[model samples]
Target: MTGSGFRERYLDVLASIYLYNEHRGYTSLDRVLDAVRQRCPDDAEFQAEIAKHRADEEKHYRMFRRWFERQGRMPLQVDSGVGHIDRFIQWVFRCSIEELDTSEIVGSEDDFERLCRVIMLTEQRGYAQVEIILKNRLIMSDPVMKRIFQIVHKDEPDHFLPYQRWLERQGRATAKWNERAADWCIHKILMLAKLPALFLDAGRPRLQRWPDEDDAITAH
Candidate 1:
């Protein structure tokens, strides 16, 4: 049980992050694909890429959930917490989750471009973090966790590239929008979500125990 504490904490964070992403995978990414189909009805290439992206994200969501079940635990709740990208969208757009479902958050062609910027930056952040996790010997020593990150990291670039290509097609505007979205997301993730998790135990692991146990036990 030498590293059990850290391991449990890591799994808790992992499960919560994936659960959060999965919720958005269904809610946001699927919706984004619908919007892409509506707007670029004739661009078969773009539509195909987005369809792949949506499928990958949905697959990721299921994978994470299955990982949790294998560990005999449920994902920690993230609704009030560390889902930074989703929270940032809610804060900036001033939209409720219900409103987000049906509403065209990406109004107009310009707004669509800006939405791409946000998605690209978020995916970039996700890519970097997953790379770090994969490189961490402590986390990756566990075969289950290692395999999961490997699969997720493989998909990150695919998530990023479509938005990037679309922005490149739009020319100089990408620079302005990209910087703005990246900065905003980084700020919210660091200031609003991540830093607080470190200090406040938002995704901290609870001591494992059997039902009706008198005291908690080590994670095994």
Candidate 2:
């Protein structure tokens, strides 16, 4: 492929990976929501906010998948070995996704808020990343990619603000620590884990090809 063609395909692959991660994220967030319910079953507002968050995630996953379908292709299999939040949890808590769910990662209310901070910060970072893509004239030149990120950008604040509001209500002094933890997990460790995959995938042949052509109609 030509250099520009490779660049376009690379961006397409990134979009597919983003879609895959959104699916992964919502699944993980569902687990988090379950834990939240266990911790505060009676907090109607928290419950409602999380329900909306869950719905938005599911919607975003569908949006990306549909975008792939519109291109007459299936999404690339995401590199799940190292996702942002997953790696963060593994590094900080030393547990796999399955273990993170089964184990009581939060012993007290403070710990629960800490977990919330991690997710809130993740969404905040997600918004920024999407914003960067949207602002890039070259990337946004593609109407489909632009529209997808635009939708995602709109939903990010919903994911973030509710958590921030909840944290504000707590009147706790843990903000700085939580921010630091988020940076460590998302910016430092997870990025490190993803670096190899980025380098390895570069210039790969037909990186965005459909995995199974016959299943396109039923793929979701």
Number of the top candidate by TM-score? Answer: 2
* Window of ten residues with lowest summed lDDT in model 2: 206-215
TM values, all candidates? 0.78, 0.80
For residues 1-220, write the lDDT of model 2, one tens digit per residue.
Answer: 7777865675666666677667768777777788778877788888788888988887887887777778776655565554666655665566766677433644577567767776777787788878887888877877887888888898889998878888887875435674666565566544554544553575544335433332355455
Q: Whole-model Cα lDDT per candidate? A: 0.67, 0.70
C-alpha lDDT of residue 132 in model 1? 84
Identify the runs in model 1 with alpha carbons over 4 angstroms from their true place. 101-107, 175-220
Write model 1 residue lDDT over 11-53, tens digit each, in one string. 6676666656655655567678888888778878988888888
Give the worst 10-residue stretch by lDDT in candidate 1: 210-219
Please give the clash total of every predicted structure, in order. Answer: 0, 0
Report the CA-based lDDT of candidate 1 relative to the real structure. Answer: 0.67
